[model samples]
Target: MLILGCMVLIAGCGCLGLWFAYRIRRRPQELRECSMALALLDTEIVWGATPLPEAFGILKERTDVPWQGFFGELKERLSQGESAGIAWKETMIAQNSHFCLKSEDWNVIGDVGKGLGRSDRTEQHKQIELVQRQLMVIKEQAETWSGKQAKMWSYLGFLGGIAGVLILI
Candidate 1:
């Protein structure tokens, strides 16, 4: 029973470690996805000449979770007569907890929200492109950190579990 208990404890610790590593690993990918999604939005607004709410509808169809949900909610809000900036801000706030991005990334995203529906297509595209550039820079940083730390976190988690079990024993 003691050995079994130790095994369970070790497994739990290892899982916790893996979870940390998973979050670290997910950050860059999520940021990349965000950048891509923005590109799509730029195309929709700038070239396709779609309205904000319709652009969001198109975007939600093409995106994955978090972004998909975000765009969908934006569409709904806009359809319900919410203002563009307000809808974007509220949707971002509601969906931020679901993303793996850092504060810097969130701030960049917020910049995009600020320009939505408040300007012409050219200006909106410029804002989105700026945010995309910022997101890429941040994504590069996140990738670098993820590469350096993800494995360390995973190994540390398992090792830390073993250490805990040994200490307890």
Candidate 2:
């Protein structure tokens, strides 16, 4: 009976550990997907030189996911700028979308930023500030969630170990 109980406990613990790991794995992918989608949206907004009437619609169609509130804020900020193209680029950079950059991509964006006309300078600065604020928020949220997840897993492991020891005795 004791052995059976221990086995069950161990199985439960293993399942829990797996579940947590899966969640941890999933989060990074979600972050990446969200980042990539945002990057793409930035590019499109700049290229279009127009505030998308259906920004959410564009995001949903491109990423096949619901628009998040943060993205909404970003869209609003971008739309407020005088020049959409410059606003888009600056916003993207300030948001630390650069973190998602590959070497080739970074180089390309660098070129684009340099080539942007002087008329868009003011809007560009505003975009940078807006994006940076958003990125900081995202980073904090990700860190907090990760810490919570780690603590939860550690507690589960300890409980599982105790159960195993009890069964052995």
For model 1, the superposed segments whose C-alpha errors exceed 4 Å read none
**Per-prediction tally of clashes:** 0, 1
The count of residue-pair clashes in candidate 1 stands at 0
Candidate 1: clashing pairs of residues: none
134, model 2: CA deviation in Å? 8.9
TM-score for each predicted model, relative to the true structure? 0.96, 0.44
lDDT comparing candidate 2 with the true structure? 0.51
Where does the lowest 10-residue lDDT sum fall in candidate 1? Answer: 99-108
Q: Hey, what RMSD does candidate 2 come out at?
A: 10.4
Residue 29 displacement (Å), model 2: 1.6
In candidate 1 the C-alpha lDDT for residue 97 amounts to: 90
What is the C-alpha local distance difference test score of each model? 0.90, 0.51
Model 1, 49-112: lDDT tens digits are: 9988899999899999878999999999999999988998898888889987777778888899
